[model samples]
Target: MHVTAILSHADEGGFTAFNPETGTATQGETLDEALANLREAVELYLEEFPMATRAAPFVTSFDVAVHA
Candidate 1:
């Protein structure tokens, strides 16, 4: 199964993650890195709490400019 992520930068030039489905977030460094780490984190989470899904990953990504 696959999930969605929303990544944003921190105040100090790092990264944070948001799982839209579960409304959870975490901090990381880069988007690629964050998604990589998030995948593992989600895996571990699901291992502890399983879900019902019998399909492969369906990932979608895009770039957006942030305004201050």
Candidate 2:
């Protein structure tokens, strides 16, 4: 099954990866490592709890006005 992954830089200097599909999260020292970790986490989660639906997440952006 296809899934989405969100990656971000960690404060300590590494990278963090999260898969919203199965709520699996992982981290690594590099982008490639982060992605690999995320993949492994998601796969492990799916091995025990398979996906029942194929609904994709709805991601959007919004702006909020703020005064300095």
Which model scores highest in TM-score?
A: 2
Instruction: Note the residue pairs that clash in candidate 1.
Output: none
Q: Give the Å shift of residue 61 in candidate 1.
A: 13
Tens digits of per-residue lDDT, candidate 2, 1-68, equal 77888999999989999987788899999999999999998989999998886777777669999999
53, model 2: CA deviation in Å? 5.1
lDDT of 1: 0.75
> What TM-score does each of the candidates earn?
0.65, 0.80
RMSD of 2: 2.0
Residue-level lDDT tens digits of model 1 in 1-68 = 76777788889877877776555667778888877777777777778888787565566778999999
Clashes per candidate, residues 3 or more apart or on different chains: 0, 0
Predictions: Cα RMSD each: 4.5, 2.0
Name the regions of candidate 2 deviating beyond 4 angstroms.
53-63, 66-68
**Candidate 1 accuracy as TM-score:** 0.65
Candidate 1 lDDT score at position 13: 78
Q: Find the candidate with the highest lDDT and give its number.
A: 2
